[model samples]
Target: MPSEAFDRFMGALRSAPCENPNRIGHAALRALQDSRIPEDALPCPELQREPCALNGVPCEWLRPPGAPLQRALLYIHGGGWSLGTLKTTRLFLAPMVRRIGLNTVSVGYRLMPEHPFPAGLDDCLAAYTALLEQGFAPRDLALMGESAGGNLVLALALRLKDEGLPPPGRLVAMSPVTYADTLEGSHTSLIPLEHILADDSFVVTKAARLYAPHTPPEHPYISPLYGALGGLPPLLITVGTDEILFDDALRFYQKARLSGVDATLLVGDHMVHSWPIFSERFPEAAQAVEQIAQFLQGRTP
Candidate 1:
């Protein structure tokens, strides 16, 4: 059973009218840009944030003073691959940045329905490589993201392996879109009841089509669950049982472990998609962030 707060959250979601699936991303970006939210807001005044470009890709760094300059966690924001921006991602990750106390770089990867497929991936890769060129060794770096961003974390790792680049020290994917086969034709038996109930399949399917257009849905870069998972970094994956991507996280963890990768899966019972990031609304969210902090520091959680 979930708490009263979880119940309230779910109730609100249920009562809220669903946005048009086709316009969700564009609408979100437009509304987000129109809002008055400050771009550099952090949890604490002591924390410093800098906007910079990595290999021509725009990025923001949220840093705790005196933290090692060599270690960084590259964060990718999620918005079904078409929404999300550096300002929004920075705000979303600010609390986590304070808790983790590590220098975190949030990538503002190019969005889709305009930029599309390899463009976002290319920007992420560029940011990562720029970090390497700046003297951060592969073993000291980590990659983290949620939802479509989570998908990118895995996709980027796969791309690195294919390019003969060293894998990062750690990876944390929260409710990633791993199996994109749902974008191919129809929703298959593999999709969970939770997803159907949430009506998230429509958004996911539409977003994927808009982003990948001509690419095969099963392409390892697009649907990482189909890719080989050997020789990657240690992984921590989290998903809510009630989310559409629950199976996505589970299947990926299973395959990764089967291939001898050290992987951990954290399932939030009765929680919705990306619930861990909603720290202020749920106790479960705070706990999840704590676990993430510990995991990133190589401490067993």
Candidate 2:
């Protein structure tokens, strides 16, 4: 039997068909907005939410006022790297908010086609740098994301390390797309039957290509599998067994482990891309949330 959270999630997701191709282009972004669940359904947490704008970046921050700063999750939303918003992410972000018990700053990165390639990375980086400048310490920061957001989190970690800074407490990646442009594992017949990863990887590749028309397919930041994982922070990666990106997540974990980084790859037979939405009802989602919360807070105890 499907967990209640999973059932609720399916009902919500089934309200609309999620069909987004090419992480770029006007049509794709429109589809992303349409694919999202209802935004007003979530009850605002009592953490004293406040809104503020970064000086130059195109993103917004939701800071929980008067809360003691613990570790932070600098979130990068997924739209195949081309389209997504911080608002659309709340369907799943709420549970993470409660579980990890950290203030999350969801960066609305610039999407591809219009902003292309490093533009998305640049936006995410800007948000991180701005947070540091705004008085947040490195010891209390981590990166997390799903899909393209997953790729961005890893890339940002590398950039931060390359700049002679300490890595975040840890990193979490969900079904990241990290491979060559050929997309050997994403377009196979097995991926489409998966309820969550049913997204067409071929379309995703085309969208990525549209965003970074000039970049090579093997760029480490774009596809971290081709990059070195040396000096990476501890990683907690989750992907569904039936999703197209399953191999991508698995390969990343295997290679990261070989490179001596602490990484855990979880392939759930009953999961799909970013299933934390049914957080209140589903036992699995609840369990996953608690595990992440424990992982985030375990060291404190």
Evaluate all candidate structures by whole-model CA lDDT and list the values in order.
0.82, 0.70
| Highest-TM-score candidate | 1
What's the CA error at residue 277 for candidate 1, in Å? 0.9
In model 2, which range of ten residues has the least summed lDDT? 41-50
List where candidate 1 sits over 4 angstroms from the true fold: 15-21, 24-34, 183-202
Candidate 2 lDDT for residue 145: 86
TM-score for candidate 1, residues paired by index: 0.90
**Runs in model 2 lying further than 4 Å from the true structure:** 1-16, 21-42, 62-67, 186-189, 197-202, 298-301
* TM-score for predicted model 2 compared with the true structure: 0.85
- What's the TM-score of every candidate structure? 0.90, 0.85
Screening candidate 2 with a backbone cut-off below 3 angstroms (N, C-alpha, C), the clashing residue pairs are: 5-281, 5-282, 22-207, 23-207, 82-112
lDDT of 1 by residue, 172-248 (tens): 99989888766322133324535322455344655677789999878888889999999889999998877667778
